[model samples]
Target: MLEGHQLLGFGFFVIGLWHLFNHTKLHALGSKSYTSTLWFPTTISRYMELHFIMASCTIFIAMELFIAPIHHQPFDPDGTIPTTHLHNFEHSSMAMSFLVYAIFAIVLDMKCTMAQHELTHFLGAIAFTQQFLLIHLHSRDHVGPEGQYHLLLQLLITVSLATTLMGIGFPKSFLVCFVRSVSIVFQGVWLMIMGFLLWTPGFQPKGCFMHLEETEEYVVKCSDDEALHRAVSLVNILFSFLVIGVTVFAMSFYLVMLRRYGGKVEYVSLVKEEHYREEDGFVKPKGTIDLENNMDDDESQKKSMQE
Candidate 1:
């Protein structure tokens, strides 16, 4: 029986694998036998690969924080003091929020591939709206009863951009790009803050080496507390890099998809047929198999051979 952290890590592993494994077969679905093994690749169908790529980080964080530490099991979530810090919740929830979007995006892509453009696009907007509001709410609360700080101002600026996005009717992909950009910058800013605080020479007290007097209920820090700190620091650094990587990947892939979509391709009408209209005298163009002029020559040659 695995512990809570192990369970959570296992769940992440499952999700991370699900999309990536399913991504490749989408192209061959429509051409061959219709089975559960097939998936058709349109813009929407192909995006599962990207979704999985982003969500993989969520699993990484889960394992780093919840599962094995650089030592073994670092017990620190309970030790993180200053509960008044709203940034704690904001940062912790970021991965989970990304997970939500990945799931919703998968469903939206499914709809879009089915040619349900309106509903699919609508769902995409709603997911964006959810994230925008979350950032706005968390940012608003971060200032604590007043809005006069620089971080507060930055939060408002981001909100304003989101508002502008809604007002001007930007395309869904563009909106996604905007969000991804802002989030990456914000993550870097947060990482810098964390590093500054950690290395401040005063963040952790020397006298309170084991946090002994804080609470009687508090258990002593594990003997490997130094190792725990190193684990935490390593994970923090890796997370920053992951965020940067994701931002670049998102931007590049979005541009690539835009390019591919902008190119002209063969047109196949997907509209429903009107069987109700009586076809009094309409002859559709003959297919290539029927258009050959060689049949007449073949018959003439046969007659000559008979003579």
Candidate 2:
């Protein structure tokens, strides 16, 4: 289970990084030309991102529903859901929602209708919403130190959900894309951290330890109420530091890309010329000026000299 959380975290981190780089590059090149996309196309394949999402979600669903179960099944002899597997079912449902989103995204992209992008964004929003709901209403513990981590994770998911919904209406807004990507990165990082902190004895809080249950899952247990409080406080502190660190890193990355691509002579000159033209309330037509004709006119006599 720890490995699974880490794997999912790494996948999210990679996707988030990919989006962060692409979106920043687009904005740095020129905001006017920067249109938000739900996913980036890969050089190897246009559907690579969607394919990745579909594949990962399928694997996760299989893990939660089949491979990880005690008897290779989620249901008991009476066809009743075992209490131990409730969380697994909830997680699989979350993955299934993402799988649906990915399938619909590919279909919408292929259709190439006027509202395709908007519909894709709406689908993405729905997937995030499903993820938020599942995690928010998880059947597992939600009051312990581990729960604190999940609570913070839900906050990040909310940001992702909100930004995805906003993308439908503001598909041209780079800020929305930027925030959404960062939130995903945060979620990935936090999940990995939670997995390590809660599962690894070395990383657990001073007075906290992992307790194995009949469900074959390890839970975080603190020695006393004070220890539990201290552990939760530490999690909050870690979250604050994570926010600061990620923000600085994101802004620094943006500046670097801006300096490398945003300063191109053509882009700068075009933007400057457009600004001046708009200010002067006039636009010069594209063509060569008739200098010879102007030089032969009466208005040129005052500026011309005969040798």
Candidate 3:
């Protein structure tokens, strides 16, 4: 039952979660060298992560442009666009923006040319902004539980856009990166939730059902208020679990890296600090303390002889 959109979301989820560790460090076996970019074992592993995002965008483009269109006519014969067609068009445009971002990002990584990190962030912001606008516009057709879900998704998209824009403004802020990654992961998870809850039958909102008319396909409405409330409550619980689970997993990965790589880094740094201090005469070098003691005894013997 996994359709293109759901699969796309899962892909984005994995990729977004991967970005959560963009700053992780890993210890090299039997070496003091520590690094976080070991996914591809390349110096450009960070760029690889960005490239994966780009690839995900491409998949979205493919689904919207090539696959989804085949199932439904994008435009009526008279050239008027239906709501569904408009939604598809909006989705494709957003994916295009992401594709543009990925290209610019690769350029920035490889050549250090036009549109640096800030520009990349700007591109990401624009892409998510498109999604936010589209979701808001498309949500007009939906009401009740489905509408509420769309509203929540739009809020997330807005947060994602804000995070990217903030990243552009505060390029050096680690918090911005953290929030951005979380937002992206949340988007993916929400997409999957929407697919299972709204698209699938068994997990449909309580007392709510889907109508499959071609023009009205993928719409869910509630017949009983109580059942709908219960379903919504269940959704909230599941969503909370998802948030906690993903957060915990990300933190676990970070802690593992810290133990393996960060600890060694600290040890190496301490050794270097001591060596520098000794060189600067602030701290005596190893074995130099014994030599100094011997020198003091010799000086006392000479003083006694002089006496």
Candidate 4:
């Protein structure tokens, strides 16, 4: 399970980073012509992002449902579901939602309908909603420092969900897309942190220790109430630091990309052309003839003719 969290975290981080770069580049290159997309096209394949989502979700679902269970299945020998595997089923269901989203996004993109983008955004919103609900109502108990981590995680998921919905309506809003991407990246980072802090004995809180349960899961237990309070407070402090770090990273990335692409002469020239047309009632051509010089030459010729 620890490995799974880490793997999923890495996957989310990659995808989020990919989106962060693409969206920033898109806006930087041409904010006026910007339109939001649920997924970005790649040089290798137009559907690379969607295909990745589908493939990852499929493999994750398989791992949660089939491979991770003690009996190699989630069900008991008597054909009933085992309580120990309930969380696995819940996780598989979340993956299935994303799989559905990816499949439909591809279909809509290929069809090229007028509402394709909106539909794609809607599907993405649905996927986020499913993820939020699953994590909020997780089958396992989330308490102590772990609970604090998950509680903070839910806030990030909510930001993702809200922004995805906003994307459907304000597809041109770079702010909405930026926030959504950042939230996803933060979620991945937090998940990896949780896996390390909760599962790794070395990283456990100062007063907390890992306790192995009958279900083969390690739980964090504090030495006393004071220690539990301290652990929870430490988790909050970590969350604040993460937020600051991610914000700085995001802004720095945007500034770099904006410098590289946003100030291009092509986009600047377009703006200049529009300004000239608006002020002069026509676009001023490059290297235009000088009317003042022409007038002066004509006057000289007239004076010479008079002489």
Cα lDDT, all candidates? 0.40, 0.87, 0.67, 0.86
Give candidate 3's error at residue 128 in angstroms.
1.5
RMSD of 1: 16.2
Cα lDDT of model 1 by residue, 1-307, tens digit: 0132233334333432342233212212231331221112436657654465355546544554544343333344576533233333443354455555556556766565653344433443454454445555663232211112223334523543453344334323334334433443443344344334332344432221223234321111223656555534554564567557755754574455445444445754433232222245445556735334578878889999999
Evaluate residue 56 in candidate 4 and report its C-alpha lDDT on the 0 to 100 scale.
84
Candidate 4 per-residue lDDT over residues 1-307, each given as its tens digit: 7766776677678788888999999999999998877689899999999899888888888888888887778898898888788888888887888899999988887788899878888888888889888888998898999888889988998998899899988999999999999888998899888888888767888889988779876678889999999999999999999999999999999999999998656445766876777788785579988687899999999999999
Residue 41 lDDT (model 4):
88
lDDT tens digits by residue: candidate 3, 53-119 = 6788787777765577655557667778776566667677777777787777676667875556666
Q: Candidate 1, overall lDDT?
A: 0.40
Tell me how many residue pairs clash in candidate 3.
0
Error of 1 at 99 (Å): 0.7
Consecutive 10-residue window with the lowest summed lDDT within model 4: 263-272
Which residue pairs collide, candidate 2? none
- Model 1: ten consecutive residues of lowest lDDT: 140-149
Regions more than 4 Å wrong, model 2 = 214-216, 265-307
* Model 2 worst lDDT run, 10 consecutive residues: 298-307
- Candidate 3 residue spans exceeding 4 A from truth: 26-51, 69-73, 265-307
**What ranking emerges by lDDT with the best candidate at the front?**
2, 4, 3, 1
- How do these models rank on TM-score, best leading? 4, 2, 3, 1
Candidate 3 or 4, higher TM-score? Answer: 4
